[model samples]
Structure formats: structure tokens, C-alpha cells
Target chain A: MHPEPSRSLPEKAAPSLTGWGGSPAGPTTLLRPEKMRDFKPGESPQIARGMGRGYGDAAICGEGHTVLTERLDRMLSFDDETGVLRAEAGVSLADILTTFVPRGWFLPVTPGTKFCSLGGCLAADVHGKNHHVDGAFSQHVTSARIIPADGAERIISPDKNSDLFWATAGGMGLTGFITEVSLKLKKIETSWMAVKHTPTKDLDQTLDFLAIDDAENPYSVAWIDCLATGEKLGRSVVMNGRHAAIGEIPLRENNKLDGSFSKQKPMPFYLPSFVLNKFTVKAFNSLFNLRQGSRGEFVTKFDPYFYPLDGIKNWGRMYGKKGFVQHQCVLPHESARDGLRAILELVTESGRASFLAVLKKFGPEGRGMLSFPTGGYTLALDFANKPGLDEFHDRLDGIVLNAGGRVYLVKDSRMKADSLPYMYPRLDEFRKVLRQYDPSGKFASDLSRRLNIAGD
Target chain B: MPGIEGTALVLGATSPMARWTAYALARQGWDISLAGRDVQELRRIAADLILRTGATVSVREFQAEDLESHEGFWEDCVDQMEDLRCVVCAFGFMGSQDAQNEAPALAQQVMTINYTAAGTILMHAAKHFEEQKTGWIVGISSVAGERGRASNYVYGSAKAGFTQLLSGLRARLSKSGVSVLTVKPGFVDTAMTFGKDGVFLVADPKDVGGQIVEAMTKRKDVVYIPGFWRLIMFIIRSVPEKVFKKMKF
Candidate 1:
């Protein structure tokens, strides 16, 4: 039977916890902070978690405790004119949008889902479709307050405590517990997205479409059809979007506040795993391509444009009881095309039908020590964690390493420790920073131990 | 279910359940007056609520044993928050009966905080809401009061009186557009019970707080948190006194 998360608190131990992909359960003691005043870190090591949306163990502290930040959610202040906000790290993007959307403000850059917390976004230095324009999430952050191993709250910013600031940006909470964040917000005229879909015949055309400067939109993503092989390899639907201007929306409507959105319907139970096998997925991909090939420019709500899967609550459960492993990698622009094609071919050749695949172009890398983006093309694919898939993923990792690409830690649950230093050339620099900040290794986590990141 | 704009007063604000309730209502756009003994922590909670939801939150000086201080708070607080719509009382004392038996001062303090202090302050709150005729009073009592065991009946009996006060107030103020709710939370995980052994089916404070907030909004009365506690307490209360007296919880 699949593990059911009990609502009990004190009575619970060894709770089955997983990220969005829902694989590799970590044995952990759960702790929730009720008050921030006189808030101090316990003697034991810990990792702060909000909603646990990081796909893997980045938020899990295995042997140590996983501090639940749900109760810590609090939005502190906002500047109407400047579009700047300061909030507790536990505050979720959804909470921000619910309050700010009507007031004409949006997140600077958001990942695929709005369920993630500001701290989760910060620790991962997450990016979105606009990465080619805006950098990672940390770029817009002005400052933050963190409690280190000593339990002393210290304010870190780009200018003030520059060293600690840069180290904590993508230090993955190795620096300490981030208590608060001061961030600049993006102003939007309306919550509607004016989108254009350009269907490409092959991988080359997809890259060409993304490279077109004049036609480039502020937000861009491509849906890759991995089932198509040979000449039709990487056949994609390139979709670009920008916030809709005031005049572009229909007259006499509260476009800013009342962007049309449907009530989400939850998937009540798990569908069997075989439903996602090759034959069915191939049929779905062909139909998806055929339908998407003809879609032209249209105005849609930001909810659907930015988060399509959010329309179906618990959509991740569609992969069934075994859960899914999302393999996301980025190769520099120089080798992105060849590397992406090979990765897709590897999956198709292995006879595994991936339910979802996405491709995006990233801008220059940020100051984050472990930020996932480079000036590259990022490709994300999901494989249901069935038998033989673990070995298949190992082989896939080898391909990524050879091409000088690195898998995203937020999405990675299985990657060899040896591959880390090779993927990130500045590993030594980050290790030094980690040593300086966390002398006792007080911020131990399953991901850090697995990849030999800060726990080294 | 209510307007996103309004104000609330959360007494015993330092409790994990109360803190969660305050944040929950604030997120729904309610201004809150955080009343508790911890001035520093209460101020922090106030600042947090303000920052998190842009709600007007104030830290009011409160003492549970001081009955005189609870007398004149109603009109003063209502004036401070322009449109006060709800008042949630999440205050109590859970002292062991053994300690109370050895020291009458402990018994008096337990009775004072759990029932006397609550009733004294709530008398003013009930009047204020009744006169304004538009809000609710949430009283956080415990399920331990439902069927007092030998281990801790002094604390349970105090809560029982507190629960009855809310019921009477509910009946008295039903027509005045005022709601009185009694919440019976079962085994919550908080700082108070952090390391207590043999704790089973413990409720998450956030969940319990959320349930309290929802009940206040939906106008539910005499509710049991985590819902299952109703059945559990019902079974405990059903036992014959002689048989129940011999057994230990």
C-alpha cells in the first residue's frame, strides 16, 4: 500500500516524506517552529522545509530533523510604488500572488509551480521560462536574515555581508536557517499572458526559433516530443509569452484582479503504472503535437500559461505508486543541441516512454555558488521509477557528464558524488565557504551527504 | 466565509494553536490584537502578522491571574481596531492534580487561568460583541474536561467550567448576531508537551489552529479538533464511574 501521510504531529515518527516527484523517502524527525521570537537552533543538525516541493532530498535532513516551515509563513512588508517586499522565508509564492496579483505585482521569476516557498526558491536559486531574460530567483533578492549554527540572527545582503550573501544565495541552506527575505517584485499590467506557439519540425528548428532575437518573448519554453526518432527527433512546440498590456484585454473587465481561472479538480486515487507505458505515451504525444502545431497567438490567464499541470491537483500522482524521477540537465550553448538530441535518443532507444519533456534557454549564470543554470539549453524529462529505470538513469548521468552538463540537484535524487566536482568547477570555492559558515556541519541533509556538497 | 477585511482579538497569543489561528485569520485580511504574557514574543507575533498579511496587529499587556485588568478591555480594544469582528480565547492551564492537592496555591492558579480568568475576560468580550451584534467568541477548552480521569481532574474540571460558560453565552447571545464557540483540542504538540511520554494520536498545532479558525468563520459551536476526538471522548465519558475510577489513563 502507498504510504499515507498522517495528520498527527507528536504521535508521528518516521513519517513517509517525499518531494514533488515522490521517490526516495527519507527517515526524519519533523519539527515545526511556532514562534520566531527568541528562535534558536537546537544542538542537532537540521534542514528547513516548506511544502517539500524540491523534487528530492534538498529539503530533507535524513538522520537529523526536517524543520517544517509551514507555521513560519508570514509576509512582513511591501512597498506599493517600488514593488519591493520583505517576508518570512516560509511564505509561499501562492500566498504572494493571492495578495499582490490584484495590486499589480508578480514574482520576478517563478519555477513551474506556485506551491514552493521563498526559502525553497532561494536555497535552489530556481529559474523559470524567463531565465533567458531575468536570471535566477536570487538576482532580485535585496537581503535576508539568517540564523547560523550559533543561533545568532545575522542580516546578509549583496553589499553588506557580501561574502555570506553570495554563499547563502545557492548554498542550499548550508549557510544556515534563512529567517527572512527582502526581495524586489515584478510589476505586471495585468495577470493575463499573451502567448504565441511556434511548432518546430526538429531539434534544429527549435534551437533556431529560440535564437531569434526579434521574435523572442520575455518568457519562452518548448515542449519536446521524445517518442519521435531519426529525422523527426526533438519535434517541439515552442511557446513564448509576455504579460498582456492593459489595452490588449477585453473592455469593461477587471483583468488585473479577475483573471479567469477554473476551480482545480484533484485526482482522487492513483492510476496503475502501466497506463504510462510506451504505446500509450506515443499515441498521446502524436495527438499533442498534431493539436499544438496549429495553435496561434492568444491571450490566456497566467495560471494556465505558467502552470498547466496546476490545473489538475495531485497531477504528479498520475505516475502511480512507484512515483516519477525527473531528470533535468543543462549543457552550455556550445553543445546543448547535440547533447539534448542524444539524451532524447537514449530514452527512446531504451524503449521508455516519458510522459513529459520540456526545453528552455537560460541566460548567463548568476552569483550563486551552486546555481543550476549556465548560458545553456536546459532539458527536463520524467521517467516513472519502475524496475530497470535506476540503471537507465545511471547511464543517462554518464551522458550528461561527458557533454559537460550537470543535472539539477533540486530535481536529482540519484547522482554519483564524483560527478559533482566535475560538473561545478567552483566546487572548491563553495566548499571553503561552507567550512567557514558551518564549522560543525550543523546543516546536514540527505542531498548534501549524497552529492558530498556542504556535508563534505 | 466572512469578508477579507475586519479585525480579531487573539488572547493567549503565545500558544502554538493561537499563533496559527492569528496568522490564519490575518491571511484572510483580519487585524488582530495579540494578547499574552510574553511582551517580547507578542510584539514579534504582532510584527509578523502585520508583515505577513498587512493586518493591523497590536501587542496588548495581559495577565491571566489579574481579574481587574480583564474588566475594561472590551471598548478600548474595539476602538483601537476600527471593525472588530472576532475574539478567540485560546488560554488555559493544565496543572497536575497531585500538585494541586499538595499546594492549594497551585489549585487556585490552575482554576484561575483555565476558568476564572477566561470567564472574567470573556464576560467583557461577550458584552462587546453582543452590543455590536456582529461577531463570534471562540473559547479553546480541552477534551480532557469531557471525562476527567484520576491523573489530572483539577485541570480538567477547570476546563469543564470554561466550556459550560461558552455554552451559556452561546444560548444567551444567539439572537444578537454573536457566536460563541467551544473548542476541545485533543493532545496537541506544543512547547508545553514537547517531551511528554506516552502521547498518542497527537494533533498538529497548525491543523488544530486551522480547524479553530475555520470553525470561527463557519460559525460552528462545541467542536472537537481532529474530529475523531469526539468519538474518543464519547467512549471515555460513557464508562461507569466505579469501573472508570479504578482504571488509569
Candidate 2:
């Protein structure tokens, strides 16, 4: 039989796109699916994009179709009694938090940024500050509805299509386009957190403090002084917090929670590239440390604690027009100290100062095929995109691989193709599912093609 | 109206703008009756809005072309919500101007859906609000109603009449403490124009929803969505008839 000819498909108009990091993506054909029912996996290669909040090019498919799921967003159902919420894949974390936070419910797991979509979070298998206790975002997800290249919607859960579910949990949306997700939300007394600041000097104390001994405080994260050298190297101010009880806040009415969406200021335009340099970062880091250090034990809203960066709109533009690359890697507990120290040494020598470097402790390995978090300490550092950055990133990847650790794919823009299989041991299984779901390799992205990841 | 702050029956609640507005209203603590011809879509929107806002949301059968159903619908909304203080009529029909030029019947149907049916529903709502002596009647008119153009004069003409009717409704309903709002949105990115060619500067439903929330809270008589559409339409309305006829936009 002959293929259908002269069928008028959606026009392939070239449009320049970029991820949250502001890295330039080559022109691609964009499609906005207005409704969940309207999405179709046509003949052309395509990738589902929501909010385009991914730091890398995972959402972009250059010279191919890129389905925009922003319009497909709508809350499907939510059981107020059970706190089991179901919504379209395009719904943002900001929407969920804004609507549900005041209702005494919170996401089981949330990343630092709330602008990301449900599908994007699931695809990344994102881990939050609570990774030490709650694991990854996939663990909270009860079920998801995914449409493969064949356009058949399959509902996957831990018990149903378990292989596909686990593969898709961090499959980078290669298995299929997620249309809907049902997840359990944690009940909260208020949208406020009781926080304490503990100042740690040097890497050893910082690591020890990050272990978070107090069971009452489930969330712990450290903002390390990456630029510090000698005795001050790895000095950090650790913030430990837990949900604030009704009496924790000063409000007389215990039922009232502070779920305000205030303090929004736009960056307006890209700052000059030279604005963030060695001297500037050092000064900002010092100031930030002092600010954190001053706050001994206080009760604050969830936004400032979970998402301080979100207050400023277009905050990525502050990185400059060329954007910045964030390198985040995790090493097992045994090698964490040495591995993180080696990476920091490289950063110290590079002369490319990072304004902020974070360290967090993880509980155990997740079940997702390509889940980024494991039983380890993860170090995250952001560097302005400049000359010789690619080679430097490759060197850092080498150090991480040598330490038997892996880099977070969500934050990575330029990881080596060969290193992926080494880090994600279940890559073979994921590829098999991809082949079974999308046999013709119809689902692809710039990240997939560059990394030599196969869908068929 | 005595005990409840706001309870609305949203007609054509499945339309992009209306659906988003319903969610906004629910979030603002208004119990909503998501009434539309497509009850399936209405039910989904109602369920979604109820969950997000913790607002009482229910689906009802409301056909835009069914003018006879107006009386029973408003009564049913009041019965269900117990204190229906608002009726948001987001119903309109846009037809191809090219076809309207060729077929007179198509033009009449456009008038019937955009003008006749809407007025009947609003009239019933206005009477109910008049009896209660407190309510809101928000109508999402279009920027196309600002003036007639060759591109979509049929839609523009029908919308123009609808806008005029809303203006009259606003004046008459004011004495009874029933507020009326005319939302003239410019280019809106919606399912109707999903894959349409050559559309740009289309505002988001979320953004438009925010504007609707402001409108309801303030009870503005007439406003343009995105607010900028007001100026754009102002300039277009100010253009002389001779110049307007020559212009194609």
C-alpha cells in the first residue's frame, strides 16, 4: 500500500524557543494542543512541552514538531476528603500551590522552582529538599495517562503497566506524552514553616549538619560557600524546617495560613554579561550568608523557604543573554566528601565563581528508570556560560563518573553521550519500553538525539 | 443573596474564556453552576473548579441557541445554588463572513445566537436579579463588536447589537443593584483558533481570567480584556467611515 499523499498537516512554521536557562534553541515547529482530547501523535517527530521550564533542551525538538501542552491544562478532579488530586499534565506547580496551599494541602514533593509543569516534574523525577525523607516526585504519583505514538492512552501505575510506569517516571517523556496525572497531596496545618539556621564552618561540619539529625525537622538544605578556600572552604548555612503548626505563627486564629503570592518583581531585561563576575559573586555570596546567618529560628511562609528565587520574574535573565549552566551531581555517601571536594577544587581553580552552591542529602535510590537522586550528597553550582565552559563541564562529569556518581539530567545541558548508560543502569529497559511504545522513533527531542537516546 | 456572598450560573462555561472565568470565580469563593450545551465538558470544568477552589460547582444543561430554556435554567440555578446572585452569559456564535455574504440564512442564525438568544437569557436573569434586588450579570462581548469590517462584519454587526443591548441592560439593572459587565476581549488564544493561520498577539486565557476576576470584584460596567484592547478598539472606532471602509485588519 502507498502512503497518503498531499494531506495538509499543521504548518511547520519555524519559531525560536528556549528553556528556562535562556539557552538558545534552534527553530522548531510548535503546536499548541487546546484540549487534552485534541493531542495526536502525527507522522512528524514530536515532544510534549509544558511551560518550557526545563533548564536544558529536553523540551525542544529542533526542525521537528514540538507540542505545547500549556493550553491542555485543566484540573480534572480532586477528592477534598482524601487530598487525591488529578489534573492535566500541563498544570503548573504554582497553580496547584496557589489553589491548594490555603486549603491545608501541599505537594508530596516539589522542586526548588514551582513554575514547572506536572509532566515536566514527572519526566525529571524531580527531588526536593525533602528527598531525604519522601524520595522523588514519582513516589507520590498514583497514576498517569500517557498517549504513545500510536495514540492509544494507557493508564499506568505501580501495579498497572509497572515497567512502563517506572520507565516513564524519569523516561524524559520518551515513552509517551503524559496527558493527566493523579497524585496524593500531604495535608498541612498551615502554609508556613518553622525554620532554623545553623552556621557550619568548613566542609566536614557542613556535611555533618546536612545529615539532619533532628527527626522533627524533615527538610534540610545547605547553602555552601563554594568560592571559599583553605579553612573556610565548604562553609555553609544550613536551613532546616518543618510544617509550622497552628500555634507556630503569631496569628491568633490558628486556621489562617499565610499563603500569599506577593513580592513579585520582574527582572525587566537581560543584565549585562559582565554584571555577574568573580568579585560580584563573592560579594553577593557574603551578603547572602550573613542574611541566612542572622535568621536564627523563625517561622516563615513556604514560598521563601522552598522557592526564594521565584519572587523575581525572569530571574534567569539575570544570568545574562548567553545564560548560565547549572552542574548538579550526586555521589554515594562514602565518596561524597572527596568527590564534592575535588569538584570544588576545580571550581576554585577555574576563576569562574558561582554565586551559590547547594548541598543536600538523599535517602536512597529511587525506582524510576533514570531517576537522578540516590543515596548520596548532591552538589549544585551555577556558572555563567563563557568560553571554555564545555570542556570544564566535561571534566566535572569525568570526576563525578569516577566517583561512581551521576549528574542530574534535568540540570545538565552538555553531558557526554557515553556517560548516560553508565549513570542510569536501567537505560536498556527504558529504551525497550520506548521501542515498544514508539516503534518508529516518532517521539524525539534535541536532548535525545544529541545523547543518542533511542525511542525505537 | 441574603446569606451567600456570590453564586453564579455561567452559561457557555466550556468556552475558553468562560471556563477560565468560572475557575476564577470559584477561586474567589463563588459557588458556580457550569451550564453549557456540552454537559460532559461542563462537568469536567465544574469538577476541576470545585477541587481547585473548594467551591460548590455543578453542571447544568444550557444551550446557547435554546432561547426557550432560559426561564427554567435561571430558576433551576437558583434552586441548585439556593442563592444565585449572578448569571455570566458567555454565549456567542462566530460564523464565516464569506459564507454570510453568500447565505442570508447563516447571517440570521448568527444574529439569533449572538443577539437574540443571549438577550432572552439575560432578560430572564435581569428579571430574577430585579426581584432579588442584588446580583451581577456579566456578558463577555467581543472587540469585533466595536465596529464593522469586511473581514468579519457579520460577526462584528451582531456583536455590535449585543454590546448595545448590554449597555441598555447595565442602565436598567443599575436601579435594582444588579451589576452588568461587558467584556470586549481582543484577540484571544482559544480552542476556536487553535490551528488557525496568521493569528498573533493573542492574550492567554489565564491572563484574561485574571482580568475577569478584577472586573467581577470591581463590578465595572464595560471593559476590554488585556485593557490594551480598549485603546486599540478606541482608535478603530474613532476612524472615519471613509477611512474605516478602506482599512483591512
Best by lDDT: 2
lDDT of 2 by residue, A315-410 (tens): 888779999888899999999999988998899889787866999999899899888899999999988888999999999999999889998877
Candidates' C-alpha lDDT: 0.82, 0.83
Q: What DockQ would you assign to candidate 2?
A: 0.29
Q: In CAPRI terms, where does candidate 2 land?
A: acceptable
For model 2, state the Cα shift of residue A324 in Å.
Answer: 1.3
For all predictions in the order shown, the interface RMSD in Å is 13.4, 9.4
lDDT per residue for candidate 2 within B120-211, as digits (tens), equals 88888888888889888888889888888887778778788889999998899899988999988888887544555656688888788778
- What is the interface RMSD, in angstroms, for predicted model 1? 13.4
lDDT tens per residue, model 1, A1-456: 112212233313555778788896778887776667534467787888888888878888887778877667777678877888888888888878877788788889999988888888888889999999998999999999988887888998888777777778877777888888888998888888888888899999998887765344789988988898999999999999998888776656566555345578898888798899888999998888888767888888888888888788888888998789899999988888888888989999998889889998988989888888988899999988899987999998888898898889899898889999888777788888778778888887888898999644
TM per candidate: 0.88, 0.90
Interface RMS for model 2: 9.4
Question: Model 1 chain B, poorest ten-residue lDDT window?
Answer: B190-199
What is the DockQ score, from 0 to 1, of model 1?
A: 0.31
